[model samples]
Target: MTKLIGYARVSTKAQDADRQIQDLLAAGVRRDDLYTDHGLSGALAKRPALDKALTALHPGDTLVITTLDRLGRSTQKMLELAEELRDRNIGLRVLNLGGGDVDTKTPMGAMVFTVMAALAQMELEIKRERINDSVTKRRATGGDLGGRRPTFTESQIRTASKLIKAGEPATQVAKDMGMSHATLYRRIKKLP
Candidate 1:
């Protein structure tokens, strides 16, 4: 028998997946067939529960989500996932897609999905352009980009190199210099 599986996600621990799960259950998805990734962003490419659900899908099964964003944070990713499902003979159903819901098993659903994908891609591109422009402007004005401070001083690096050249163990050298062994070894590699 064909099964209807649901996937739900929340980006933070403060958010709840109960609302999405309720909607999925109301749509007739079995509780056992539902997968959830809590405290994980949709933007992340690696989601363990989501992967498990996709792997469990069989041909002719339907994958349901409360919203398209629950499937993916970006349109490109959602479209890629949709194409994968279609190629596998699986159906995708989203509860809140514009004026009506989307079921990729139908012709109208396919068209609507394509249009939405295109619009989302355009929106992302525009956002990228705006961010790039803002960054460029800030750089031109000599604003700090914000990053971590250097872990080792020049004198400390030089001492580390000398210690390493003198056959001192990296761990010992790092302990003597009050730094990490890995940091000491990395500084040694940069010695000319």
Candidate 2:
């Protein structure tokens, strides 16, 4: 008989994996066939449960997952896993992709997986570009781009400078002003 393996993952302990487990069980996977990784980031390559699931897969087995994102957030990583499964002659099924079998070897299924991976990669790149643009705009403004804003007013800067000139250490000055040492250093760096 052909075996079916299920993989489930949640990035944080606060997120529940019970629903995924239940779904896999309802899909006819035995408890022993289900591998779970909780409180583990998808970016991690050394996940124990995922490693076990991959090792347990054989040429004729079917690998099932709740969603693509549960397997990995990165398009490259997802594609890598899919390719690995294909190399092993293992079948891949995702619950979100509909209840039926999805044969990656078929032309239509291959096209769909390729398009999904490309979209995921594009989304990540767009997000990174937007963040860079935001940072550039903030730097163009006279804002404190790299450090904490000064809690001390202009009067406080004048006082802190006076204290420093009077031979007080920045640490002591910050302690007296109820600010952190790093904040004091940043304030001093901004000073003329």
Candidate 3:
């Protein structure tokens, strides 16, 4: 008997996997045939549910996912997974794929999968290049590459220093200046 297995993932607990589950069930996959990974990053390799699903797969079985990105964010990883499935004579079905079925039994399906994998890889590379270029431009312009600016202003640091010079306790000065003790101490260390 042919079996169909479904895989779904969500990166955070805040995201509900109910929709994916419903879609897979609606697609005729049984509840027992579904595997889910929640609050797991796509970059992680050691997902327990994913491993169990792979282990449960037999030759001629189909592994279904709502989207290819749900399988992995890295194109290399996705290709590796496809190769593994092919070696086992298993088929892959990505619901988000446009007008093509990627079953291993057909040469055309394999070609389509290969082309999709290559396109995903190219997309990731282009995004990385754009990000690197943006970072380089920002660095050249003296813009903070860090995600956020520091909380304390130069005037606040000067005030903290003056308070320290007036024989005020660091903790008290920090409280009075509405800053944390660690912040005040760091500013004090920067003074001559």
Candidate 4:
């Protein structure tokens, strides 16, 4: 019998997959039929759970995702995957599609997916351009490249290092400097 297998992913451990899992379950996918890869970016080619889910698929089965983006960030990769699924006689269902979910078991769904991929590719290109422009603007203004500014200045770090070398505890020095001991050591390690 054909089955609906769900795949879920999160780019970081800080993010939760509960929402996707719930959506898949609500779509009638069994809990045992769901596979997930946590703390894994869609850009990565090798995801253990994704691999297993693909392997579990067979002819007449449908691979379901909460959204198309869960398949991957690359339009080309997503298209290639759909092609492979098509070749194997397996269908694809994206639950959170724009108007309605796209299930590639139908010709109209296949066509809609092609258009969606083209739009996704364009969006990716636009995002890249925006990032490049932002970096260029920041560089032109000599602004530090987008990261949190160091809480401890170079001078504070230098003094904290000296204090540690002069028999003071690292924890005490860090506490006095209003930062964590690990932060203090990380800064000291970066010092020349």
Candidate 3 residue-wise lDDT, 111-189, digit = tens: 7777787787687789989999999999999977888566777787888788778898888989987878997888767
lDDT by residue (tens digit), candidate 1, 1-192: 999999999999999999999999999999999999999977899999999999989999999988777777677788889999999999998887796678999988877887877776677679989989988998999987667887777787887788777998878889987888987777777766
Q: What is the lDDT of residue 132 in candidate 4?
A: 94
TM-score of each: 0.64, 0.63, 0.69, 0.82
- Candidate 2 regions off by >4 Å? 98-101, 128-192
Error of 4 at 165 (Å): 8.4
The Cα local distance difference test for each model comes to 0.87, 0.81, 0.83, 0.91
lDDT of 4 by residue, 27-110 (tens): 999999999999998888889999999999999999999888788888889899999999999999989889689999899999
lDDT of 3 at 123: 77
lDDT of 4: 0.91
Task: Check candidate 1 and list the clashing pairs.
Answer: none
Ranking by TM-score: 4, 3, 1, 2
What's model 2's TM-score? 0.63
TM-score, predicted candidate 3 vs. hidden true structure = 0.69
